[model samples]
Target chain A: MNKRNKLLIRKTLISIVMVLIVIVSLFPIYWMLLTSVQPRHELMNYPPNFYTRHPTLEFWKFTFKESILEFFNSLVIAFFATIAAIICGATSGYAFARYKVGGDTLPFWILSLKFFPPVVAIVPYFLMMRTLRLIDTCTAVIITHMIITVPFAVWMIKGFIQEVPRELEEAAMIDGCSQLNVIRIITLPIIAPGLVVTALFCFIWSWNDFMFALILTRNKAMTIPVAIAGMREAHGLMWGEVSATAALGTIPIIIMAIILQKYLVRGLSLGSIK
Target chain B: MTVKKRALMLVLPTVVVLALIVIFPLVFSLSVSVRAYDIRIPEHPFIGFGNWISLLKNPDFYSAVLVTGTMILAELFFELLLGLCVALLLLQLPRSRKIFQPILLIPMMVMPVVVGYMGRLVFEVRSGPINYFLNMLGLESLCWHASPDLALITILILRIWRWTPFVMAVLLAGLLSLPMEPYQSAQVDGANIWQIFIHITIPMLKPIITLVVIMRSLEILQTFDIMYVLTMGGPGAKTMTLSLYAYITGFRYWDIGQASAAAWLIMIPLSIMVTLFVKMMEKGEKIEQAK
Candidate 1:
């Protein structure tokens, strides 16, 4: 084959593979959505319909009824946790970035907490929450979730702060601006995008958490994941209701994931990529 | 405040909170691991090394270890291999990438619990789409999470699906950031695509590869949400991972001592791994800064 023909063939092949990747990537979610809308009879068919003939909003209504309260609980907990984490993480992250506080050991120590197994902490956290009489409260779940979100926020914010040059702050200081004002007027604006990303991530992590929410909260403080997991009927899973809830839960995250796609690799790798 | 005090003020709240949350738990778990503690029991006595001994002897513990080992190895291998291939493909299609990349990341964005439920629905023996497709391909239906033999594999499939996107995104970013001169030189020297990739791409991408491996392994170690929703580590404990085992022990059985012991067992290696990786990352950063 001529070189042009070969190049054309390779491009076609790449396109085909990309199409397949998109399909495989999306098919499960499509199935979840398909299952959610199909009426009970249609779902029970041996060969499932690729496209639903008669769709129903029954399951969506059921899901909302079952999980709306838990969704509210999740929102409150994740909101507070994200705010707390951003507060604790951004300040400390700035300190680490600018001052090299704790001489690297402290920073590494803090980052290591991100990798600490939630299982290990679950028992102690459960006991502690129980002792504090915070069991079955949003406060309990919020505090335990900080263990995950704070370290993550710290590491991410630290990386972001490092990316913003120290010269700007120094220049501001030389201009006789107070340190706090320098941070307010200079560094904060530069790292505002980074802070937003950090907050979104902390929110998602806290929102999607199941293990902590599962072990920590009883019915009153149950989060969406726990509620979705408990959508089990007598025979088997409440597949329709579960999918409806799962689909709803996932859509917002998908939107956020798309919006944050540029910073995703950096976030996922904990800034190692940058 | 002096500069040092100002820095301390900035750093102190996080440290104190972490100390109470992270450090205190470390010590608390250790003490709990040594004690013969049960949530139901009133008198909890210290039984030095007793829980650890029994945990070491327990068949379930060993089974969980086996499951966890298999998960880490299988998930990492498949995810890395598939992720690399997808990333390379995406890299080849720069124009299409902008449109396709966000679509590709949808899987990773799905919650783990939801992923588990999806696995159940998609892998359902009686009416699952997978079985229907298998039958269309002239094959018999296979029991996925329902059968003990296939439970771990089912979980692995779901996990790989969720995580391969993350690995791909990271590796793709690494690929995009790579200096182009080396590849141009290799091409000019008559090196083929395979040679250029094997020699040039792999070496440059080593740090990112390490980053994904460590990150994925740490996550796989704590594989609970999916398992809890999918198999509950069942079909006779076939899918019982260490985290699930620890959770079951602590919550379901209320054997806090044994659970704490299991937690420590998991944490020790985790801490060591994190320390090594952080040091390596720091070294890499230093080298980069110097350059």
Candidate 2:
């Protein structure tokens, strides 16, 4: 074969591999959507219906109508937790970056806390929450979520803050601007994109969290994942209801990803690569 | 004194919060591991390694360790290999690089619990698409998650699916950031792609690769959401990872002592990995300075 033909062959092979990767990556989610609409009787059909033969909205309606309240509860908890985490993380991150109040070891120590497995302190957290009369409340869930989100925010924002040249803040200080005013007028505006990314990450993480919500919250503060897990009954797995719940849980995140694809992608890559 | 006192006041609130949320809980977990304090029991006694001793002897605990070990090794192996392959592929593409770059991160953004549920549905015995596709290809249907022997393999597959994008993203960044002089020189010397990779690319990428491996391994060791959502350590503990086992003992059984002991045991491996990572990073810094 000629050189051009060889290149063509290679391109074709690579395109095929890429297609396969996309299909493999996307098929499970596709199956989840397909199965959610599948009728109960047709769910277990052998040679499983690749496409829904008798598609219905019964499962979707059941999930929303029956468990809508729980879904709202999850949304409320995640929303508050994300806001609180962003506040704590951004302020502390700014403080660390600007003020040399503590040793460098302090920031590393804070970040290292992120590596502590939630399971390690989960039992104690549960007990502590109970003692504080915070069990089954949104406050409890939000506070527990801070353990994960604050570290993530601090780490990511610290990187962003360090990248912001120190001269701008120093110049503002020389102008006799208060620390709070410098943050509001100068620092926050400069790091706005970073803050947006950090907030979205915190939101997604809090929404995705399952273990803490499962252990700490019962009915009042249960998140989406816990609600989905509870969808299973003693009889058997309600395939349609479970699938519908999963789909509902996933749509918001998928939409957020598509909308803010740039920042979300950049943030994920930064956290992974750096 | 006043200035120092003001600085201390500013830092104190954050320190107290961290202590309450992080340090205090860690110490409490350690104490709980050595004490007999079941939530059901009001009065407790200090057991002093009784939980640790019991866990060491338990066959299920051993199984969990084995499964966790296998999962981490298998997932890391595939993630590194495929991640490198994809990174190389991305590097070769000149025009579509920007478009394809962001698309690669979709998997990492999908929630782990959602990934698990998606896998669970796809790997279902009768209705799952995997079995359906296999049957269409003139192969017998395989029990993906139902079979005890294949349980860990299923979890490993899910893990690789969810995390390979993470490895790809990091390696891609490293590959793109690298200077082209060495590779060009290797090409001028008539080195083949394979030779260039082994001699030039791998060495240059070692520090980043090491970082990815250690970070990914630490995260994988503590993985819970996917395992819990998919199999719940199912088919007779075949997929019982250390994190999941700890969750069961602490939360399900309410065996606080045993759970805390298991948690500390899990941390030992993680701490060792972390120390090694820090050392490797320091060595890499020194090498870079020397060069």
The numbered model that scores best in lDDT is: 1
For residues B1-291, write the lDDT of model 1, one tens digit per residue.
488789989999999998898878888989999999977676789999999999999999999999999999999999999999999999988898998888888899999999999998899899899999999999999999989888899999999999999998888888999999999999999999999999999999987888888888888988898989889999999999999999999888989999999999998778777877798778877886798
TM-score per prediction, in order, is: 0.97, 0.92
CAPRI quality band, candidate 2: acceptable
Best by DockQ: 1
Across A1-274, the per-residue lDDT of candidate 1 in tens digits comes to: 6998988899889999899889988999999999999998888588779998799999999978878889899999999999999999989998998888998788877877888788988988888888888889999899888998999899899888888878878888999999889989998999999999988888888889998999888899989888888876333667788889889888888888877888887788877777
lDDT per residue (tens digit) for residues B42-88 in model 2: 77799899999999999999999998888878988999999899878
Query: What are the per-candidate TM-scores when only chain A is compared?
Result: 0.95, 0.88
Off by more than 4 A, model 1 = A233-236
List the TM-score for candidate 2's chain B: 0.92
What is the Å distance of residue B109 in model 1 from its true position?
0.9
Q: Which regions of candidate 2 fall more than 4 Å away from where they truly are?
A: A1-9, A39-41, A53-55, A172-179, A233-235, A259-274, B1-11, B275-291
